[model samples]
Target chain A: MSFLSINSIAHIISAIIGTGAATAEEILYFKDIRDGKIDEAEARHLRITYKIMHWSLIILVLTGFGILAGVRIKYGGTKTFYSPVLWAKYTIVLVLLANAVLIAARKMPMKWAGSLSLTSWYAAFALGRITEKTREIKWLADFLSKFNFVELYLITMVCYILAVAIVAIILNYLKKIIIKKQ
Target chain B: MSVLLQFSLISHIFLGLLGIILFYAVLMVLFKPIDFKRIKFLRRVSLLGLISFLSSWILGGYYYVVYYGNIVKPLIKKSAYPWAHSIFMEAKEHIFLFLPFAALVAVLIFYILGEELEQKQAIKKTVIILSSLIVILGAIMALTGIIISGAARLR
Candidate 1:
């Protein structure tokens, strides 16, 4: 397979594994805490899950940008740095990822972790959708057509991060019911 | 934006957010070692979240078909990438997709695996792990979708 194919497959596989780790960790984290072993398991699980997530993130950024650049070259166009969508998307991803690191690394409180994780995930999805849809639009097609893959990847992450923060705020406000329950 | 776009976007955003919230909630409860005091509340919250997330996904999918069929279809008759599309979107149409399946399995596995262990602790641990995976997978899907779509520019 070509580089793109390989990258895609790798991303998928990594996602599966990374998610599995995350899933396992989340469950175990709660278990450990209840068992009064949160301290012991927290570091190990955090390190492993963080590493997996970080590497998967690296693959995501690399491949994401590569795809953008490849597309621009294929379409014989170039997206400029001033692109609003691009800038927005990148900013969002940055915020989301930063929060994720803080939470996963245990810098943030558990309450914040829940809120932050929710924010980051939503933001990523929002920005991703925006970027994808914009590209599909004829008017947007030409404008976003520029930039190397790396550049686009950067922009996409930014958007993802910002989107998460925005959504998180809303969810947090509505968290009254959940907070009460817990 | 137009009505369809607005409708689609709203649902998309809602479901997306719902999924994230539910995924995290599950993790927090599961990872924290099921306090009997928190069990009823956490389970209730999780169930609600699951309902909200699923509803969002359903609405989001509806919007995808309607909007894409109307807008993106002319450019690319079928999905530009059939294999990826099938795994992520098409297969998801029937539910029991990778994510929900993984989630279900996590729930079942947690119940089975931790049944004999400390009730609250095992349950919490199992839920957290499962939910965390689902959340991460969701993130990957979102990121990869963009990358893949952008890459299609190459084809």
Candidate 2:
């Protein structure tokens, strides 16, 4: 395969790993906290998933940039590099990186961070998969392309904030359910 | 584009990326308590990040002066969204100058202060802010470059 193809495969693999890790982390978090506290096993499981998330992120960035460099070499900066959807995805990745920093600093609330982490990862994953060429979403292509970079960014962030709120509510509800069961 | 121009363009991007990654490393290191043992290592990384930014500045400046102004500039200007050049590139080039200067100051703070920085909470905070500033500015420059390039291609 060509250099681009190899990098593309690596990028997709990393994305899958990242998305899966993020999902597992959330699910495990809820399960581990069912008793209102974390045991050693729960802590270990959470740590392992976090490590997976971090590793997958590093791989995703390396492969993603490699793919960009390859595209730049062959095609210069085409729409593929700067489309609204792509830019939205790029900003979401930035948010993810920034969120990780906040997490490391122990600055953000765990609830907010957890919600942001889960939502941003899924948003980035969904944006990567859906494109203008997909026959089912062909109309989405024409529809989304109308918005500029700033609009898409605002839309993504608004949606992101809303998702965080919604997820937080669900988590709280789940916590009550668990507490009542106990 | 000629082979030389392509090389310059790619090198410029690679260096910019290197600079961003290094500062990110610096921030990650600083996110924890200041390690007296890692002070020297911290300075080294900060210095390298500064050099990367300055080097990228020179390389990107060469690309802009030699080829971009004469050819790519006009193509982008005449494109459907001339604002990509008129605004994004215009603002980006000016704003990019801030990055190397900030990185240099950050390097100097770490180098000259050494472990002394650990004692001064305010100074440590400033250094962290500077590193964060560099990362944010670098991301903006990269994204703006993408916009400018896309405009040139479509036109």
Which candidate should be chosen as best, given TM-score against the real structure? 2
**What docking class should model 2 receive?**
acceptable
Q: Name the lDDT value of residue A153 in candidate 2.
A: 67
Candidate 2 lDDT over residue span A6-121, tens digit each: 87899889889988999999889878777888999899999899888877776776677667766766776676766666777887888888988788878978868887888888
DockQ, candidate 2, vs. native dimer: 0.40
> In model 2, which runs have C-alpha deviations exceeding 4 angstroms?
A1-3, A38-48, A132-157, A176-182
Q: Top lDDT: which candidate number?
A: 2
Contacts from the true interface found in each model, as a fraction, amount to: 0.02, 0.43
lDDT of candidate 1 at residue B6, scale 0 to 100: 49
For model 1, what is the error of residue B144's alpha carbon versus the real structure, in angstroms, after optimal superposition? 4.7
lDDT of 2: 0.82
Candidate 2 differs from the real structure by a C-alpha RMSD in angstroms, to one decimal, of: 3.0
The models' CA-based lDDT, in order, is 0.52, 0.82
Best by DockQ, which number? 2
